[model samples]
Structures are given as structure tokens and as C-alpha cells.
Target chain A: MFSAMIKKELLLVFRDKHALMALFVLPAVFILIMSVAMRDQFSSKNLEFSLFVKDLDKTSMSQEIIKLITNDKHLVQIKEKGDAQFFIVIPENYEQNSNEILKLNVQKSLKENEIEVFKSLLSEHILKARFHYISQSIELYSGKASKILANLEISSDKLYKVKYKNSKKLPNATQQSVPAWIVFGMFFIIIPMSTIYINERKQNTLMRLNSMNVSVFAMTFTKSIPYFLINQVQVWIMIGVGVFLVPLFDTPALAINGSVLAILEIATGLSLAAIGISTLIAVSASSSEQATTIGGILNLLLGAVGGVMVPKFIMPESMQTIAEYSPMAWGLDGFLDIFLSGANTQDVFIDFIKLFVFGLVCLGISMIILQIRIKKGL
Target chain B: MIKISNVTKTYGAKKALDNLSLEIKEGSIFGLLGVNGAGKTTLLSILNALVEMDSGEVEIFGHSLSKEKTKIKSLSSIIPQHLAFYENLSVGENLDFFAKIQKASQEDYDKAVSVNALKELMKQKASTLSGGQKRRLNIAIGLLNNPKVIYFDEPTVGIDPKSRNEILDSIKNYKNFGITVVYTSHYMNEIEKICDEVAIISEGKLVEQNTLENLFLSKDNKSVNIEVVYSNILKELNLKLLDETNIEVPKEQLCELLATLEEKNIMIKKIDYGSTNLEKYFLKRTGVEDV
Candidate 1:
């Protein structure tokens, strides 16, 4: 009996061309589009940075420092004040050894004749009495430092060393877009699956099945198997194609296999959810339109929240946390782990298990609700 | 054989089938007759174990409807009111698929002649098949299950006359093969023609049950006819005061009413007997004339 049900489901899925596009073509299209979009993000490129110097002391040393800072390819010196987005301020006593010199040490790096002129000018000041031994001592150190600096200083100074950090450029839209497309495909395929089941009830097909000695569980599970298999194969094909198109980090087989497994598992669970929802809707509806509308709302809500339309990464942290609660997010997360993270099957074991359990729970609820609804003649 | 006791089904405040008891014998074509919203389909659904009842004990072939649902499901087949095949699949594929669901092995196709013949038609897409052909497919699907009992809910609805006859014949054939048939329909003539016994349900209650012949013969209500220039008299007649079937009016009032009708420019073209057919009988039973 189970075999018969399986055969029936397979036939139904294969017969509809629209279902084929949704299950097979849609996922691959999404993978292609997203990968292409994100292609740039994964590339190896150095980030370009511009530096601006705001020198309070316009000394020859400051000029040398600016030349050195501009030497690195990654860092460019912006001469125009308005063009400079960031500035590094150099304090007047920045290089001073504070322990030895409590005063500003501008004289320590200046010429001997200039220091003597500075001392003679200070002696002739109106506040000569206030020039204590601390001031005289600073002048003596400045005169000695200037003579030493003339010998130690090189003709050209290398003041700053600019090293650029390695960065991977964001992939273009196609590569970045594929995963989201896969999610969309998953959602798109569900429409037919939901309608197929709901239409059965509307057209009295389920009632006919009920009369046929086929258990409800068998019917529901069997119907999902074909969809699961189709989605699994499509996910694998998409991943395989993606590996060739985008410079995927993971091997084709591992990536395709693990991601396929995750996708299939989630598809199965989601299909069960669809069946459960359809059964409940079909009871109240005398027409297929009602069922389709209700199913559409559910698929849309799940798809939107679960990252089919927008990737979860860009969403707020709180939204990402909420997305984890959605079934689609779990599926997408598992796939991404396998594809992008190069994770093995064991990594997705929990996700698959959760999805499987979700399927079972949905099916159980569907059966109970079906019983109640049918009894009430809704 | 199917048996139900104290079955009740309600939707909010509206009772669909209230304390209904019925027994459908094996190897007979039983017709369930009722007006729209009269609980015929509800009763069939319950019997098929497709839905549960509010309070009921149902037994099919000695298996409890609730506890032994799987067994019951295996024993029964249903031909629904609409086409049930996967329109995308060819006829043969559809049959093969349904047969597999019923656990009827393809290797044993030769053993089930009807199913094998149906399978041969699998090349044709279900949507491409004629209406009669689709109906036949529906019946053929039931045979795959090899059910002991089958329910046909308005099986010939919207079908051509020839197709209707063919479906009825097919149903009879099933009965001849000893499969219990529970046929539900609002069409009185079809029930009178095909069903050995008929049961009338009204407003969720089983109002009458007997052989088709006896149900029509045992009418106990006064039949009255009134002619008027305008059809508005029907709305004016307060039908609520009457009992289940008969209308009560004074003789002098009846005469005066006829005289008033004649005095007006109303021409009494003809006066015919009321409550003449199975439909009228149902209306009388339900206490609503506009069937």
C-alpha cells in the first residue's frame, strides 16, 4: 500500500510541468543569480585606505614623516583638507621623553645658534626673575640635543610604515544571490504541493482516497516523498553548478551531498507542514480557491521571515535570531554550513533531525485536525 | 455491512446529522436521498471514516469505525462527486499509481482484470479523457482497492445521459460482485432506478427509510394545489403552521380563495397533484416545499 502511494505521488509530481520548474529549475536559477551577485565579495583584494596628516608643528621632521606614510600602496596621502576624511594630529611635544624633560622639548631637536638666540631673548624678557634654574636647565639640554641631532639625523627619514591588511572583496550579485534563490525555489515549489493536496480535498479526491482503504499517514508521507526527492536532486544539481561557477571553497561532492541532504530533509518537513495546513483549510472550503489562498498566506509568511526574499545575514541580529525559529531558516542554515563552511554531514545532523521531527509533528496535528473538521462537517 | 448508532454531527449551532441511526446491508445498492444541506454527504463521509462524528458508534464489517479505521479503509472504496485522478498523468499511469496505493501489485494485474484493462488506458492524459471516461476511471480506481463496500457520492453528477447509464451499470456490476454500494444523490429518479432501498435525510435527521417502492407508496399527507396569476402566492402561504406533511384549511376559505382567483383576471390553466415524485416526498418529509 505504501508502495502504491509512493508511485501515485511520483506520478503527480512528474506530470505537472509547472511543478518541475518550481522544484528543479527554480533552485538552480536562484543559485546562479545569487552566486553571480556575490562573486566580488569572495575575491582577494587589498582594501584602499587614504591618510591625512594634521601637523601642529611644521618642522622638517613632519615633512619626512608625511613622505614615509605615503610610501605604502594601500595608503595614499590626501593633501586637500576638505578631501581628507580622517586626520592624525601630531602634538608639539609628541616625541619628548617626559621623565627627563618636564618642559616642551622643541629645542632638543633644533639648531644650536637658534637655541642661543632663544636663551639671549629669554634673558632680556620682562620676567627674568621668574626664569628659575628649571628654565636654564631646559635651555642647556636643548643646546646639547640640537648638536647631537645634527649628526644622528639622516638626510632622508622613513617616519611611518604603512602595511595593508588582506581583505576578500564582496562577491557580485550572482554568487551572493544563489542561496536566496534556492530558498525562493523551495518556497515556489511548495505552492503546487500545497495546492495538489488541497485540490484533492476540494475535488473530493481525498475523500475518494479515504474510501480506498489507504491510511491517512501513508497518503501524507507518500505524497511528500516525491517532493523531497525532487528538491534533494535539484539542490544537489544547483550546488554542483555553483561549485563550477563560483570558486566554491568546498569540494563539489561534499558540498552538494551535504547541502542536498539538508535541503531534502527540510523539504520533507515543510511538505508535511503544507499537508497539515491544507487538510485543515480543505475542510472549511467547498472550493479550491479558498485552500490556495490560505496556503499562499502561509508560504509567503514562512518564506519572507525565513530568508527567502532577503538573506538573514543583513537582517538585524534580533531578526536573525527569530529567523532561526522558522523552518526555512534552519534548512538554509544547514545548506550554507555545508556549502560555504565546508561542513560534513554530521554538522547538519541536528538540523535534519529537527526538520524530520517538525514534519512528523505537523502530520500528527493534521490528522487530528482532519478528524475534528470532518466530524464537524466544515 | 455498515451500522451506525446515535451519530451526531454539528457545526457551531447548526446540527448536520442529529442522532442518526442507519444500517446498510451488504451486497445491496443503498441510495441516500436528501436535499441540499440535508446531511447525505456528511453521513457518507462518516461511514467512509473520512471524518469523525460528534457522538457515534459505527461498525463496518465488524470493525469499529474509529478504532479499526485502517481495516475499514481497506474494506471500502469511494467514488466522489468530482473527477479524482491526477490530471497530469496518463490514464494508465494514474491507475498503476492508485493500484500501488491500494497495495495491489502490478505483477497481479492479470488477476484483477478490471484494473489491468484500466491500466492499458494509461497512455492518455487524464485531462484529455472524455467526461464518461474520467468517471469510468474513478470507478476503476475503486476496483484497485478490491473493497468489500464502496460509496458513490453523486457519481453521475454533470455526466451525459449515456455516461450516467454506464456508471449506473458499472455500480450494478459491483453490487452483483457482492460489494456493498452506498449511493448518495439528490436526484430522485436516479435513486428510484438504481437503488434497491432508499433513505431520506433532512436537516441532519434520517426522516424516512424503506424500499424505493414503499417510500413512494406510503405517503400520508394531503396534497393541495393552488393556481394564481402571480407566483407570489407561494410566499404568502404560511407553511410553518402545517404539520410535517399535511396542510389544514377550512372548506369555506378554500372555496372563497378559488372564487377570488377566478374573479381576478387569473386564468386557471390546470390543476395538478402536489407531492407526486420522490423530490416532493423529500420536501414533505423535511417540511419545506421549495425543494
Candidate 2:
């Protein structure tokens, strides 16, 4: 009986072209559009920023420091403070007074990621200037200190590595967009899922099944399995877009840095969560229009808060904390753990648990609601 | 067989079912006649255990309704007024799917299709079928469980007369399969033609319940028209004339009025009488003209 029911559900899902497009194609499109559009955002190597430097002393040392900051880099030295993202001031008699430190101020509205990049470059240049300053004084180059200063390779410093601690591979734009939008699209299962459920309820198919000894829980469970599988398929389709399609537009391909099992765990957990919410709304609302509007608005709100629309790393600390509470964020974080940090299933256990528990609660509530509605002959 | 005792349901301040009790015999086509919000649906829902009565005890086939819900579900099915099957599936698929829900054998699946004359339309989507065909499909799926009792709630409504006749015949045919049929409708002719027994409900209470023959017994109606010879005694008897030839008199008074006319030396030409003038009986029983 369950096999036949699952087959029926599969047939329904396969036959609904609009649902198929919403579930699969929409995420893949997002991955492609987002990855290609924001290609240069994640790669600091190609960033263009300008530095405003005021050499108060007009000395050779400050000149050398300014030259080092802009050497072979796109960080051009600008005379106008308004045109520069980084403002550097060499205080009076800085070469003479050891207490006078280089004062650097950044533009107020720069994104945190862009600020971190500028800070890394500035730190590297300052250290290199110290090396050149020490080399000029032969007395300071004595014993071990002389050897360490002389051997320093500050000129070619690998300043700010984007890779997480104890992990390999710098996550690029496609890597982030693919998983982020895949989670967003998976949550959209509420749309088609609620639609089918509400249709059944309104058409009295549920009443017929109830009369035939079919429990509401059984129907909900049967429905969840098929959509969960669809979500898995949708996940891979977006991955395929990230790996093959996005690169067609000249962006780097998505790198799978962890085991496939990690992806499966998060995908299944997130799918259940999506299905749970869908079923709840399906049985609760009086009409399909109500379900769609409520579900659509809910998904949009979750997407916004969960950092699917905006990366959490770029959000402020407080907003990121709020994002951690969203189920979509849990899904996104789980995928990022695998895709960006090469983390395995054990590493994503927290996210998986949160999603799994949330899903079970929603499904449990939906089952109760359905049973109540049926008992009331709604 | 189903029996109910003191079934009562209330929605807020309004009583939806007021101590309604009814017995539906096995292998009998029972019709429930009522106006809108007349508790027929509420009674049906209670029978199927789709609802819980505020106060009542119902037993079906000797099994307690509340305790043996699963048993009742397996033994009964309802053909809802709405199209119940998945519209996206083919007729064959719907039959197969519901049979699976019942865990019935392949024979049950084949029998449902054959019984409803759906064999030719098996490949067609339910949504593509005509109105009458869709009604037939509703019955076909309901029979998948081989239910001992089936309920039809206005199954022929909103269809052409030809299709309505087809559906009524289809429902009447269920009696051959020995499935108890509880049909609800507003059409007086439909219940009169098909039902073995009838129940009239008004405002959530049973106004009447009896065999169709008994409910429409001539002895109980005052509108049984008598066709008698042209006579001035009918005027003296204050008999109501349905036309010049027909005199509307109570069945009990018909003979008395005729004898009076004979005593008056009026020549008798013809007379006509039998049973039910069901529309009037229904209206008089329920005190409502609409049902």
C-alpha cells in the first residue's frame, strides 16, 4: 500500500511541471546568476581600492612606506581623502619620534569583508616598511635579530588566507551561492507541497481516505518521503549548476571539499523541515491561496533572516547570531561546513540536530492539526 | 447494519444534530431527505466516525463505533458530493491506488472498475472525464474497500437529467451487490424511485422515518386526489377539486364521499387511487415546502 502511495505521489510531483520548475530549476538559476554576477566579490586578489597618504614629515622613510603600500598592487595612492577607501597619516617627525605610529582610517560604509582585505594589505606593507627601515641601520642588524630581519619575506606575504582554521580551499562565490540558494529552494517545497495537500483536502480526497482507514499521519508521512527525495534531486541539480553551469560564465566551479554523506544528512534534515512546515500550513489554512500567501511570506522572511539572501560572514555579529536560529541558516551552515571547510558529518552534527528536531516538531504539530480537523469534519 | 442512540452535536450555540437516532438496515437503500443544515450530513459524518458526537453511542455490525473505529472504517465508505479521487491520475490509476489503500486484492480493483463501467475510460485522466463519468468514478473508488455500507451525498446533483438517471441507476445497482446504500438528496423523485426506506429531518431533528411505502401510505395523506363522476355532491361535501374531474380528498374520506354521491343519484363515470403523492407527504412531514 505504501509503495503504491509513494508511486502515486511521485507521479503527481513529476506531472506538475510548475512544481518541478519551482523546486529544481529556480535554485539552479539562482546559483548560476548569483555566482556569475558576484564573481569578483569573494576574490580579494582582483579587488581595486585606493589609499590616501599624507606624508607629514616628507622624509625618505614615509615615502618608502607609501611606495611599498601601493607597489605592484591596485591600491593606488590618492591625494583626495574623499576618493580613497583607506586614509593613512604619517604624523610629524615620525622618523625621529619612535612613539608616533602610522594612523590609518577606513571609510565608514565599507563591507566587513572589504575592510578585512584592506587591513591585511596594510599590515603587510607596514611590516615590510619596518624591515626596510631596520636594514638601513646597520647597527640594528646584529646577531640573530640582524639575520631574522634580513631573512624576513614581508614583500611577498600571504596576508589574509580565507580558508578556515585547519581546513583547505578558499571558498569562492559559486561555492557559497550554490548551497545558499539550494537551501532557499528546498524550503520552497512548502509552495507545491502545501498546494497538493490543500487540493486533496478541499476535494474531499482526505475524507475518502479517512473513511478507508487511512490515518492522517500515514498520508503526511507518505507525502514527505516523495518530496524529500525531490529535495535531494534538487540539491544535486543546483550542485551541477554550480560545478558545470556557473563555470560556463567564467566563474570558478564549486569544489566539494567533504564527503557526500555530509551533504545527504543536511539535505534530508532540511527537506524534512521544509515538508513539515508545508504539511502544517496545508492542513491549517482554509484555502490554497491562504496557504500560498502564508507559506511564501514565511519562506521569504526565513530566507532573509537565515543569510540565504545575504552571507552570514558579511553580516554584523548580532545579525549572524539571529541567523543561527533560522532553519534555513542551519541548512546553509551545514552545507558550508562541507563545501567550504571540508568538514564531515560529525562537524555538522549541531546543524543536523537542530533541523531534525525542528522538522519533527512541525510534523508532529501538523499531524495533530490534521487529526483534529478530520475529527471535527472540517 | 448501523444503530445510533441519542446522537447530538452542537456548533457554538446552534444545535447541528439534536438527539438524532436512526437505524439503517443491511442490504437496504435508505434515503435521507432534508433541507439544508438539516443534520443529514452530521449524521453521515458520525456514522463514518469522521466526527465525534457530543453525546451518543453508535454501533455498526455489532462493533462499538468509538471503540472499533478501524473496524467501522473498513466496513463503510462514503461517496462524497465532491469529486474525491486525484484528478491528475487516470481512472485506472485511481482505482488501483484506492484499492491499495484498502489493501484489497487485484480482484477488488477489477470489480470496482467493472461495476462502475469504467473499463473504457481507464486510460483517461479523471479531470478530463465528463460530469457523469466523474460521479461514476467517485462510486468506483468508494467500492474499492468492498464496504458493506456506502453513503452517497447528492451524487447526481448539478448534472443533466440523462446523467442524473445514469447515476441514480448506478446507485440503485449497488443493491445487487448487497451493499447498504444511504442516499441523501433534495429531489423527491429520486428518493421515491430508489429508496426502500426514507427519513425526513428538519432543523437537526428526525421528523419522520419509515419505509418509502409506509411514509407515502395513502391512508396518511390528505392530498390523494380522487377521480370520480361529475357530481354536485362533491360541492355539498366541500371536497377540494383538482380540476373538474378530480376531487382532492383524504384517502379515508374517499369512499364516504363516493357513497354520498351515489345516494344523491349522481352517475359515476370513473375513480382513481393508489399510493404516494410523495412531494406533498414530504412537505407535510417536515413542515417545510422546499425539500
Candidate 3:
């Protein structure tokens, strides 16, 4: 009976292309896309995109500014304005005319933050050129600029070193995105889980099973085992995408410095948590549409609050505190501990316990609701 | 044999089943007939253990329903009004899964499959099956373990006439195999066609329990049902409103009732004369006149 039930559940999920996409493909895509897109932010690198410079200023100062900004590793100073996401126009005689300001034209689609960072970098470089001329007490664009530049150390990037407690490896985009999305994807088991469960109830299959003497607990157990395994598979596949595919786009591949077993434990805990809540949702809802709606809203809210869409460090302090309360946060933190901090099973054991207990409580409540509904013949 | 003694169930202020007792003999197809909300489902649920009677003693095949629920459950299966098989699975897979749950032998479901004529659709996904085929699969599932008793909860509510007959024929066939069938439906025609004995419930109380033959034979042979349409002219006379916009009176009073209605400019709608089947008996017992 157990084997047949397990097989049936497995077939039910696998045969549903939509469920497979929700559980597997969507997360894999998110992991790849998010990791690549977040590369610059996590790596402390300048934004990478096309830039166009229209240097109308015929002065040496404008030439110097153009040289410095173009020298950035990620920015390419192109001549075509159409190709450039950011077009900078150095006003004519900017060094001679004190009233003139540099003008920058940007595409509407450019991310606001990246543009801000680029603007700051441009200002910083311009100021450094002005300070050099003032320190030398010479007129702007004097040939003496090269003489001073030869002796001065203009780069300050190395002065501030990013450290992660005692860890040597730098945390990168893949590290954050891989774990966060895996946790997010694992919870989507609710979608398919709620579907099958709601169908079972609406069809009176539950009553039929009861007549066959199959306990609800037995049914829930059989359902959980398959979904838990699916979650594990989902985690590994997304990790494979991060480890093997994300790097092809120049983003750093995911590095799992923690024990693989520990990661699996965290994933397992998350799977249980997801199943528990999904069961509750399924039991509470009257139809598949209702289950999907409730489950969808809940997953999105949880993901948003749990640092799945945005890293906790980026959130305000109060928001971070709230993130700590989301079960998804518990799972994400557990994975991050291993992925970024290289912690082992022992380090994430508490997180696992938190998730496990939450799952059990949900399952307990769900079972209670299910019992009430069954007795009430809902 | 099955016996329900003084079963009472309540939902808030509504009593769904009030001290209802019944006896269904072994190997007899007993039909529980009633109108909507007549506690037939409540009784079926009680028998299937899907519901708990507020107070009652139900014994099936000499097994106490409460004390030996698992034993009783193993002895019977229900064909619910709703389809219950897994639509994602093939018919064979669903059968195999339920068969496993019931600990049924290969020959058990093989016989069921053959009886239900599902051999060709074995590999077809259940969702793709037609309505009649779906109903057949439902019965085949209940027949998996060859339970001593089977409960049908309005299984043929909506379907083509051919499919309904096919379902009825299969349900009646289970009796030849010595399985006690307890069928419930509001459709009196179906009960008349297949049921040997019937228990009519109204407002959670049993109005009648006897063989279908005895149930009609024992009714007033001289009296029949007189139905009418209402008009303001006949509003002066007090009449029993068993159903909305309908009334029933004994056949002996048909002329007087018609005369008054005709004199009052009211028209006679239907007069069920010289017939005493489960429909009229059920209508008479439940205080409902066929519209």
C-alpha cells in the first residue's frame, strides 16, 4: 500500500507538466537569471554596459575625465549614442567656464541604482582631476598633470578590504541567489500539493480511502515523502545550474563549501515545512482555484519577507528583523550558512530544528482541520 | 444483515437524523429513498463511518459500527455522488492503487474490471473517460475487495439514460454475487427498478421500511394522489402545501376538491389515479406531491 501510494503521488506530480515547471524549471531559471544580474552588486565591480562620451570640451581637463571614466573595466566608451545605455556630454570648456555642469543622458530602462553608482564614480574622477590641478597650483589642463600623476597612487580600491568574519572566499551573487531561489522553489511544492489534495477532497476520494481503512496520517505521510524527495531533486538541479551554467554568463559559479549532507538536511526541512503549509491550505480551501490563490499569495508574501527576492542585508534593520520570523527566512539562512559561510550540518542544525518544528505544527493543525472537515463531511 | 437502532444526529438546531432505526436484510438490495435533505446521506455516512451518530447503536453483519469500525469498513464500500478516482492516473493505476489499499487480490479487481467492462480503458487516464465509463470505474473500485455490503450514495444523479441503466444493471448484478446493496436516491423510478426493500426517511425520521412490494401493497389501494394548481379563487380553502406551489389529497376527496377548485376557477393540474408505486408511496409517506 505504501509503495503504491508513493508511486501514485510520484506519477501525479511528474505527469503534470505545469507542476513540474512550478517546482523545477521556474526556480532553475530564477537562479540563473538572478545570479547573473546580481553579479556586479555582490562582487564590488562597476556596472557593465555600453557608454557614449560626447566630449565638447576641448580642454585637457575634459580629456583627462574621459580617460579616467573610460578606463573602468566594465564601461566601454563607444561613439554610437544608440548603442550606449548611458551617454555623457562634457560641456564645452568645462574647465574654463565654472557655471557649466556635465550632462548625462541615460536610457529609460537602465536600473536606477547602477546609474547612480556610475554618476558617483564620474564625479569622483572629475574631482580628483580638479584637486590635482589645484594642488599643483597650476592652470587647468597643464602638461604638468602627467608629471604629478606618475608619482601619485590614484587607485583606492585596495584600501578597503571586504571581510566575512574568518572566511577567505568572497561571497558572490551565485552564492546568494542559488540558496535563496532554491528555498523559494522548494516552497512551491504547495502549488501542486494543494491541487492534488483539493481534488482528493472535492472528489470524495478521502471518504473512499477512509472506507478502505487508510488513515489520514498515512495519506499525508505518503504525500510528504514524494514531495520531500522532489524538493531535494529541485535543490540539486538548481545548484547544478548555478555550479555549471551560471558561470557561462561570466557570473561566478555557486560554491558549496559546506557539507553536502548538511545542505540536504536543510532542504529536507524546507520540504517538510512546505508540505505542511500546503496541506493546511488544501484542507482549508474549497476548490483548486481557491487553493492556488491562497497558496500563491502566501508563497509570494513569504518569499518577499524571507529575503528570497532581496538579501536581508539590503533590507532596513526592522525589515531584517521581520525576515527572521518568516519560515522561508529560516530555510534561506540555513542554506546561506553552508553556502556562504561554509558551515556544516552542526551550524545549521538549529535552523533545521526550527523548520522541522514549524512543519510539524502546521501538519498537526492541518490534521486537526482535516479531521474536523471529515467529521463535518465538508 | 444490518441494523441501525435509534440513531440521532444534529447540526446546530437542525436534526439531520432523529432516532431513526432501520433493518436491511442480507443479500437484499435495500433502497433508502427520500427527497432532498431527508437524512439519507446522513444515514449512509453513519453506516460508512464517515459520520458519527449523536446517539445510536449500528451493527452490520453482527459487527458493532463504533467498536469494530475498521471491520465494518472492510466489509462495505461506498459509491459517492461525486467521482472519487484519481484523474491523473490511468484507470489501471487507480484500480491498482485502491486495490492495494484494500489488500485486494489480483483476481478480486480482475473480476471487477471484467464485470464493469473496463478492460479496454485500463490504460486510459481516468479524466479522459466518458461519464458512463467514469461511473463504471466508480463501481468497479467499490467492487475491488468484493465487500459483503456496498452503499451507493446517489451514484447516478446526472447522466444519460443508457449510462444510468448500465450503472443500475451493474449495481443489481452485485446482488447476484451475494453482496448486500444499500442504494440511496431521490429518484423513485430507480428504486422501483432495482431495490427489493426500501426505507423512506423524511425530516430525519423513518416514515416507512418494508419490501418494495409490501410498501405499495400495504398502502390505501382505494386512494390515489390528486394534485392541483393554485389560484386566488381556491385560496379560501385550506390545503396542505407539501411542496412549493403543490398539494396532495386522498382520491375519495378528489371530486369535492375539484368541484371547489373548479367553482373557485382553479384548474386541476395532475391526478395520479389507480397507481401505488414507490413514487406515490414515497410522496405520501414524505408528505410531498409530485409536481
Q: Name the candidate that leads on TM-score.
A: 2
Whole-model Cα lDDT of every candidate shown, in order: 0.63, 0.85, 0.85
Candidate 2 interface RMSD (Å): 0.8
Q: At residue B167, what lDDT does model 1 achieve?
A: 73
Clashing pairs in 3: none
DockQ of each: 0.44, 0.73, 0.59
Model 1 lDDT tens row, A149-246: 43342212243444422211222344345555555555554466666776676666666666666556666677767766665566556656666754
Worst 10 residues of 1 chain A by lDDT: A98-107
Better of 1 and 3 by DockQ: 3
> Rank order by DockQ, top first?
2, 3, 1
Model 2 lDDT tens row, A152-210: 78644443445455453445898889999999999988888888888888899988888
Please give, for residues B1-291, the per-residue lDDT of candidate 1 as tens digits: 788888998867989899999988889899887778988877878877777788989999899987988788888877777788777778777777777666775544433436324545668888888887888887777777677888888988787998888777667777667889999976666777788888878888888888866764563423344433444443455532243323333433566655655665445543423224567677767888654
Name the 10 consecutive residues with the lowest summed lDDT in model 3 chain B: B272-281
- Model 2 segments more than 4 A misplaced: A49-149, A155-171, B222-239, B242-276
Model 3, docking class: medium
Residues B1-291 of candidate 2: C-alpha lDDT, one tens digit per residue: 779888899988999999988998989999998898998888898888888889988998899998999999899999888889999999888888898879987787788888788999999999999998898899889888888999888888877899888778878888998899999998878887899998888888988888976665646654456666675556666668787767777777777877877788776565544333777777777787666
**What is the TM-score (0 to 1) of candidate 1?**
0.65
